[model samples]
Target: MEINIPKGGITITKLLLRICSILIIIALVTSVDGSKGNSASPEESITILFTHDLHDNFLPFEVRRNQGKYTVGGYARLYSAIKEQREKDPDAVLVDAGDFAMGTLFQTIYASDSPGLRMMGQMGYDATTLGNHEFDFRARGLAASLRAAKDSGDAIPKIVATNTIFPTDDEGKIPANLQALKEAMDHYEVKDYLIVERKGIRIGILGLMGEEAASNAPMSGVTFDDAIESAKSTAATLKNDEDVDLVIALSHSGTSDEKSKSEDELIAQKVPDIDVIISGHSHTMLKEPILVGNTIIGSSGEYGEHLGVLNISLDVNKKWKVNEYKLIVIDDTLPLDPTTSETIEKYKQLIQEKYLRHFDMEFDEVLAYSPFDFTPFSEIGIELKEEPLGNLIGDSFIHTVRELEGNDYEPIAAAVMPYGNIRDSFGKGDITVSNVFNVNSLGIGPDEISGYPLLNIYLTGKELKTVAEVDASITPIMDEVQLYVAGLSYTLNTNRFIFNKVTDVRLQDFDGTKEEIDDHKLYRVVAGLYSAQMLPYVNEKSFGILSIVPKTKEGTPVTNFEDQIIYMNGNQEVKEWYAIANYLKSFDKIDGVPQIPVYYEQMKNRKVVEHNSNLFAVLKSPNRIIVTAYAILLAFVGIVVLIITLIVKRRRRKK
Candidate 1:
């Protein structure tokens, strides 16, 4: 076919071609830079206000940093920040990533009063996910909390857990407590995903438990599917079946600066359809939004230290673009929400009446007054060193154990507390009973109580050295494994081989006297129930190189940690928090307040690290592990050299 055009005039076909080219250019420009072209689909925005790893901080708490005590975080202030954002954008969606319970004294009533959930409701959270800490009291407690929240007639946030699997028996029926949990979930309308329309925007939100989060919740009794796979399937449904315009993931999975370890970032990279992800679990505080393709990932710091505000607006291509993102610091400057404050106070009273009275203590009873601040919680695991706070807690364990055992007391060689278990540190002021509890307020006892009970185990001196080696080695890879001891001291040379970092180990008295550790002798060790339970797993974490067998005094391997619980009075479990509290109360009083002595004001050389690079220090006392590592390295080098020589000879012959 032939088309003819007049001299300088365009034919019908030419005119149509020109118009199509112009449209194509306009579309490309619009897609490339949203600001370039004008599209009929005007931009619309949706604001998301989020928090994670709140850990039941219903009231403002003190944090000692930079030689000063600063008051920060509380539900009331968090709600005030949320209200401010909502006022600016009424359609803003409020969400939490998880770990809403089990940190403060408020968690004492988690199963009974459901304060965490009810308070989130009052704060107007639209949706939330479950973090590992939510299951700290185990499945039954979680079920009870859910039931309590539902029965209270409070408007709790809708929960969406896409990957959380409720295990079934061989008969395809869930267990009793799990069944109860399932029923509560059903009653509360927990689902894989939820769809909400706000200001003409349809948003789909789904929640997921990350790999690390799931691993941390060993007692959760529920398993989780792969986060990426669950997210892929759920996002597909939200986009294809629900026909939603936006997909937001409320992932308890966390982000890291390292792409290999960042769970949520991996999810975004694998699942492109997800528009936004609210990350939690690691308690990361991203200063700015992380944009993966078109996806925006945001995380607020833990303990409600900050509230994340993510603003997204639709671009010319009908894709979401981040307009603004900021984390509002929840500090004393923010005015507290009156109703929320009152509700929290009511929960406090409930805690005092129902929980505190059992221990014969008031909510704010002063246990001791510290003249100097201990180690700040933020700096606890940053470096592998002796921490004054750890020293105090470990000493408290020994003190309580000795006092409880009284005449039956066997010398406690050491009491170990891992950095992971130390939740908070005391500032320079009156340390109240609440302060002591908050420091070790993790895990539940066999009595289904809030705190982890103390337990006694015996470790051979050889194994104790291994514990020091584990701290010196494993802590670099996993900081939570860092161990602090009350009656033990060890020196480590950092330049030594990986697992042989500890060069010296000894048992030290609190009075600064050192005693040699007999390698084959059994030493009684005291630690929190949870820490003792985790001691056996160190072998697995260390890949069989190091083994720690926690045994009874009669040399029987422990299977049930509950049986080892150290009791104070007849069947009353000696809770870890109470041990610290009792130790504080025993301190000499000055002017009616128990005074923490200056002894704890400095590090006690429990963990002395020699960071020398001298050849002698680096090569000093190579243990069996180091010798094996060297042999392996030499064999590998010899094989490589032989292969190179063979290759050169073969090439010469060919030439």
Candidate 2:
């Protein structure tokens, strides 16, 4: 120690001690920073299981009458799949894209009380967006559904549609009922967006309603803003202000494989920050998630047939990227989770019992049907070529209109039924009364046009040709123009220009005999309301050759054709139509008539041309108001009963 007492020994010792002190301080600072980083790391990862466009398919295994096989899909099965995925990851998020409240009779029944949403809540859905069909009953129906979801207890899904604005009265004041509805929405927990946190990751989910919803459904008091603008605003808020790590848009609009303007695509392009877009409305099945820059778009096919699963991973920095994505075809191969299945079954029974009590009938009676079969055709089938279902629907519509008019005006020709509008079909067999109701279940009210008696008019052959041409020329136009017709016969030369395809125009009366037609003459026609809008073409046409009578036989004005026809077809009836189509097509001959071409070439495009006897019968009959009213009233009663029962049950639960 004495040896260390060299020159400046104490000073050197002091310097060494100071250097050690600095090193210790640095070490302490580094350890504290490390601890902070560890603490700041995201707590846990989450997987989101999403489904959309489930059009009220609560049971699986649709029996294929002709093939004698079973198709898989049902709420019970879907519930099981969701539960299994959730259990696998306790933090899994479940969501629905939209179009969850219409399509099947089940939906019509549950629309008012939202049995579907209640069931979804029980199944643990985090959020849901409003589809166009959500407004099928207009504001009243949507309000009721929001109410049901709130009363169910589990946080009701955030009813997020940024673009939809509630309208004010003439005095520029919000109506009391509407204000109450808004308050109910607030009380019931239906929000525009929801920030869900799991394992320390904040996920922002917003909803979008399709533009088509505003036009197709009765959104009289609500206005829908531009999709892109709404999306950008919502995304900006979530990302900048909320500081959300991931943003998901549940869009009711759809993306097509073909070249088309999609709301989802536009939203992605305009609002680039969104991480994922779960879409529906068009009911398209994306083979894989579509990658549009940083956004991943996915949609599960409609009717509960598919479950969309997306797996994502977040980095230590809290940035997210899609790790895996797939649309799982929900079938029997996948094991069904017991807990979810039990819950689904419980709800199913409850719904069934409630419906029965409301309807004063048994569950089986509600589902009972005769072995009737008819072919159902889509809009494409009618527009591109002659479809049996189209012909039948057109005929039924014309006959109904004529009967309502007291048989004053005989419809010379009918137009092709607009493709997407015809929702059901007629089948062969006993054709029970229920089947009739099912065939016409969409409850569009009666119209009161100004000019003529309410004669629902269909475009003539030349008019159809013109409309078709317009439909083809306008790239972004909707399919609403292509009209379905009945009691008319004409040749379509797809090779010709618009209005030129229709040649050899003649009327095929009820007796199947041809009647003369004057190209300039206007005859009373019957068609859907969507078709009536195109009637304006009569005024705008180059020829100025046609005029719409706009009156029924009873001299009533035809204001709203779509509203006039109520109760299209029930789900079972629709299935029956397909079954009949398949069955008839299978036979080499029916009623000694050779099976018509199920597939035909028109304008170089292949089309399905099938026929059904039941449809033919409906078309042949004169439309009687009494008959139509009875059918509609019966269907309405059924739907009302089901809805009331669900509402009462929900109220009881809340109490």
Best by TM-score: 1
Candidate 2: 10-residue stretch with minimal lDDT = 446-455
Summed backbone clashes in each candidate are: 0, 54
lDDT digits (tens) for residues 1-655 of candidate 2: 3235566466666778899999999887644232121222443455889989775566563434453444577776787788777778888889998877665445544534566777677667888877777666556656766776666665445666667677788998877757766765666666668888766667889888767655666544567777778888888888877777788999987886563657688778778878889988878888778878778888888778888888877666655567777777778876665665675556556555543243233332322222333443222333455555555445445444444345464544653455555554543333322333334334322221100111244344454334433433221244444444455555544443333234344666645677766545455564444446545654454244333334443545556554333222221111212222223323345554334333211121112222223543333332233356568888999999999999999999999
The most accurate candidate by lDDT is: 1
lDDT of 1 by residue, 1-655 (tens): 6467769677778789899999999987655332222122346678999999999988889877666777899988988899989999999999999999999999999999999999999889999999999988888899899999989998899999999998889999888878877887888788999988786667899999999899999888888999999999999988887777889999999998788999999999999989999999989999998889989999988999899999888887777888899999999999988999899889989999988887889888988999987778887789988998889989999998888778988999999999999898888889988888898999889888889999989999988888899899999899888899888899998778789888888999999899999989999999998889888988999899889999988888988878888886687888999989999999998999999999999889999988988988888788888899889999999999999999999999999
lDDT score for residue 485 of model 2: 49
* Native RMSD of candidate 1 (Å): 8.4
lDDT for residue 259 in candidate 2, whole number 0-100: 38
Whole-model Cα lDDT per candidate? Answer: 0.89, 0.58
